[model samples]
Target: MNAEFVAVFVGSSIRFAAPLMLASTGELISERAGVLNMSVEGMMLSGAFLGAAGAWATGNAALGLAIGMLVVLPIALLQAFLSVTLRANQIVTGIGINILALGATTLAYRELFGERSSAVIPGLARWSPPGLGAIPVIGEPVFHQVWLVYLGLAILLATSLVMRRTALGVALHAVGAAPRSVDQSGLSVTRLRYGAVLFSGVMSGAAGCFISIGDIHTFTEGMTGGAGYLAIAAIIFGNWKIGRTVGACLLFGAASALQFQLPLIGVHVPTALLVMLPYLLALIAVAGLIGRQTAPLALTQPFRR
Candidate 1:
C-alpha cells in the first residue's frame, strides 16, 4: 500500500477506536469498583441523541456536547441506585436501561426533527497538535482529527495515572476486590460504587457525543451501532488492564477500519463479517480462547452495609 493508503487507514482506525477508548476506560473503572455497568450502550445512545438535539437547537456544538454529557447523569444515577442501593440484578437492569434508551431516543428524534430529519447538524471542530499537523505526506490525515480525540487521549492518560498512582485508585481497587474490607476500614462501598457508575455514565455520554457531533454530526435512530458492547469487549479482551484495554480498542478499531480499507485494495470480504469482527473477537476473548480470564472478585456482587 502507498503512503496515502497507510495514512487513511491509520486515521480511520484512530477515529473508529476513539469512542471505544473513552467508553471502555470508564467501564474499566466501574468494573474495578465492583459494578458491572451493562447500560453503557443506553448511556451512549442517550448522549448521542441529546447532544445532536442540543447542538441543533442552540447552534453550538460545544454546548451540545456539555448538555449531552450532563443529560446522561440521571440515567447513570438510576443505574447506580438500582445496582448499588437496591442491589438489583446488574445484568437485568442494564438490559432494561438499554431498551429504554433506544425507544426513548427514537421517539424523541421523530418528534423533534420529523420533516427535517436530514438537516445538517453542527459538528465539533477539528484540531491537530502544533508540530504533528505540519508533518509531510501523512501529517494532516493521520494527526488531524476531531478535538475530542485529543481530549479523550488526555483523559485516558489521566485515568491511567489516577488508577495506578493515587489513594483514590487504591480505595477503588480495594472496593472491587473486597468491599467488606473497604467498609470495615471506613470507606463507603455504596459511595465508591455510585461514583464509579456515574463516572462510567459521563464517559459513555462523551463517547456518544463524539459520534453524533465530533465525528458524524448526525444522529440516526441507533447511531452507536453496538459500540458500547464493543467497549465492554475491549475491556474483557484487555484483561482489565488499562494498557491492554487500550490496545484491544485499537485492534477492534483497525478491524472496523478494514471494512472500508479493504475495498480500496481490491480485497473483497463479506461486509457482514467485517462488521461482526470486533464482537466475534470479543466473544473469543470471553470464551477463554485467548487465555485464562480473571475478572474482579467482587464484580457484579452487591454490597450491603
Candidate 2:
C-alpha cells in the first residue's frame, strides 16, 4: 500500500478496532475484578439498539450515548448482585444476562419500529483536522474520524493509568487476586467488583454507541453479531492490558477492513470465509494459548459476603 493507502488502512483499522477495544477493555476490567460478566454480547447489542433509538428520539448522538450507558447499569448491577453478593456461578448469571438482553432488545425493536430490523439514526458528525486534511498521504481517513474514536483512545489511556498508578486500581487488583484477603482488610470486595462491572457496562455501552452512531450510523438487529464475543477474545489476545487489547483489536479490525479490499486486490475468497477471518484468527490464537496470560486467581469465581 502507498502512503494514502497506509493512512486509510490505519484509520479504518482504528475505527473498526475502537468498538472492540472498548468492549474488550471493559471485559478485562470486569473479569479482573473476579467477576465473569459474560453478557457482553447482549449488552453490546442492547447498547446498539438503545443508542440508535436514543439518537432517533432525541436527535442528539451524545444523548443517545448516555441513554445506552444508562441502559446497561441496571443489568450490570443485577448481575453483580446475583453473582457477587449471592455467590452464584458467575458464568451462568452472565450468560443469563446475555439471553435477557438479546430478547429484550429484539422485542423492543419489534414493538416500537413495527418489526423493521434496522435503520440509520442521526449519527455524530465527523471532522478532519484543519489544514492537515489535505495532506497527500494522511488526508480523508484518520483526520476525518468521529469524536468517539478519540474518546476510545482517551479511555484506553486513562484505564492504563488507573491500572498502573492508582490506589483504586491496586484495590481492584487485590480483589481479583485474593478477595478473601481484600475482605479481611475491610475494603469491601463487593463494592470493588460492583464498580468494576459497572465500569465495564459503561464502556460496553460506549462501544455500542460507537457501532450504531459512529461506525455504521445505523442499528441493525443482531448487528453486533458476535463482536462482543470477539472483544473477549481480544482481551485474551492482548494479555488484559488496555493498550495491548487495543492492539489486538486493531489487528482483528484490519482483517475486517480487508474484507472490502479483497475483491479489489483480486483475491476472491468465499464470502463466508472472508467474514470468518476475525473469529478464525481468534480460534487459532486460543489454540496455541500463546504466552498464557493468566487472569486473577478469583476471576469468575463469585465471592460470598
Best by lDDT: 1
lDDT of each: 0.94, 0.82
lDDT of 1 by residue, 155-266 (tens): 9999999999999999999999999999999989989999999999999999999999999998999889999999998898999999999999999999999999999999
Q: Which residues of candidate 1, in runs, are more than 4 Å off?
A: none
Clashes counted in candidate 1 amount to 0
Residue pairs with backbone atoms closer than 3 Å in model 1 (clashes):
none
Best by TM-score: 1
RMSD for each model, in Å, please? 1.0, 1.7
Please give the clash total of every predicted structure, in order: 0, 0
TM-score of each: 0.98, 0.94
- Candidate 1 similarity to native, TM-score: 0.98
For model 2, name the residue pairs that clash: none
